[model samples]
Target: MRLIDSYRDKKTVDILLTQIGNINVKHKYRFMEVCGTHTMSISRFGLRTLLPENINLISGPGCPVCVTSQGEIDAIFDLVKNNDVIIATYGDLLKVPGSNGENLYMLRSIGFDVRVIYSPLDVISIAKNTGKEVVFLSIGFETTTPASAALVKQLVKENIKNVSLFVMNKTMPRVLDFIANQKEVMVDGFLCPGHVSAITGERLYEPLVKSGFACVISGFEPVDILMSVKLLMEQVNKGKFWVENNYGRVVKSNGNELAMKLMYEVFEDCDACWRGIGIIGKSGLKLRDNYKEYDAIERFNIFIDYDKSLPGCRCGDVLLGRINPTDCSFYGKRCTPDNPFGPCMVSNEGSCAAYYKFGG
Candidate 1:
């Protein structure tokens, strides 16, 4: 059988759902899926409707674009308006609204040089061809860090002076730690990010497990998610807070060592800002001193002060899993995808976008 078909097999999904249902637990269980892709998959498959009423799945600050602070969005806008450099970024970032109610997409329409790049390496070609300074807006968790690091490594080796990186890359474990310790959040188990797990491995979740949270490394497929839910439910009921690997086909105990080595070599831990959720200590990655010449923040003298939360926008609470998107007054009424007021509404991986598109 093909890989996708094997994971999406109806018989397999039914069997896993049955296994999950058989684990009769009386307690109200809340499992947080920490990967945005998992959130979309859960919604896309309508997996929540099939699960028992006691098993409540919530979304976390897993969407990179959604979690990117308003201050950073403001900084990006400032960088674009005040400078002559070309902005190369992934497409999702183009629509995320800044505090000034402007986005890269709007700026591009008004004649700013904003290019949607598929990969970080594309910046090298853009810089070389245009003979103009190019700033690559690097964003994502561990899954995309290695590529950005490689881009930096290449620029340094080639002595490319026109290219710089505006890095907004964040690490996952620290944020997970923050969520697990929050007294109000009520997360019993974490359906950990599968792609991030591929880079950092199972050992990365050991600390969370030790702190008394069930951590399951899950894939995005239907069977994968259902199987993860089953494992998480069993662990929670038995009071065994262990790290479980349900997606063993890709994830490993230690993760990809080469990728980890490359990532850390170019970037180091620093405090990062999350929209709605304040600053997290050592939760973000910044370019190392050796690569300071390629740092956009330093080159441009841009400093982000604080994020501005729009009135009546409960995106922050939604990201914390304190409330569902439906609880927000503006979710479907005013905050549709085409006319987004918050970052959560703009990114496809965002919880609000998932809830809006797939229906809770």
Candidate 2:
């Protein structure tokens, strides 16, 4: 069998599922998988249905677009409406609505130059070809931040003057810390994000383990996820809490050090607002003082202020794993993929989107 197919082998998946089922845990256990891909994987594979009733797999603030504050979304819309610059961002962000229900897709239809880019490096060509200022809407966790950092470094080294970054890049650890302490949700352990762990390493979650939480860095495949759950069950069975590297093939103890160094060189920590979870301390990345020339907010003289109230929208609760997407009153009615009432419904990786699409 091919190496990629080995992770999807049904026999191995069933074996891991049996192993997870054999664990003799009497109490209820809630484990949150804090990645958009993991959420999608779980929903797509129907892993939750195979698990025992004692175990609950919850979704956290993993979707970058979903967690971005409405104020920032409004800021991006305002930037496009008032300025004559090219706006480039990821495709998932195209449909996300501002506080006033305006989005880049709508703006693009009305003659705004909004382009959907697959990579951060794509903006360089757009800026060079158009001979106009291009502001890239950069957003993601540690996994995608290095690429954005690399883009900034390249722009600086080449003295590219027309491109700037509207950075909404967020770090995972601080927000994880916030989630760990919140009483609204009960997370006994974390099925840590494989992609982010590959960038930040296993050591980043050591503090949470020290604080008495089970953590297993998990991959996205069926067997990989099942094995991760088996590892977490082992911890619960033994009454021991530790960081288990179930995804060691990609994640290292120290992570990709060079990538992290590149990221920190261009960005610094700042307080950031999560869409439904309020402001988290030092959970986000901003361009460093030396790289301030590439900051879109500063260049355009824009202010970001979040409108925290999303009346009747329980997206925040879904993000926190306090409630499921189906529990929301407007989830299937007012909130759908085509017409999203909240950001969670807009992004493919979002919990609401996952549940809605796959019936989780």
Q: Which residue pairs come into collision in candidate 1?
A: none
TM-score, candidate number 1 = 0.98
Lowest lDDT 10-residue stretch of candidate 2: 304-313
Scored against the true structure, residue 238 in model 1 reaches a CA lDDT of 85
| Candidate 1 lDDT tens digits, 1-360 | 687999999999999888887787577889999899999999999999999898999999999998888888888998998989899999999999876677888999999999999999998888889878899999999999999999999998888999999989999988989999899998888999999999999888999889889999999999999999988988888888888998889998889999999999999999998877899999999999999999999999988766566677788898899999889999888888998888788898988888889977
Which tens-of-lDDT digit does each residue in 1-360 have in candidate 2? 689799998888888877777787576889999998999999998999988899999999999999998889888988998999999999999999877777889999999999988899998888778778999999999999999999999998889999999999999999899999988786889999999999999888988988878999999999999888888877876878989999989999999999999999999999889988888999999999999999999999988887655678888889999999999999989889989989889898999999999979
Candidate 1's displacement at residue 17, Å, is 1.6
Residue ranges of candidate 2 with Cα displaced over 4 Å: none
lDDT against the true structure, per candidate, is 0.90, 0.90
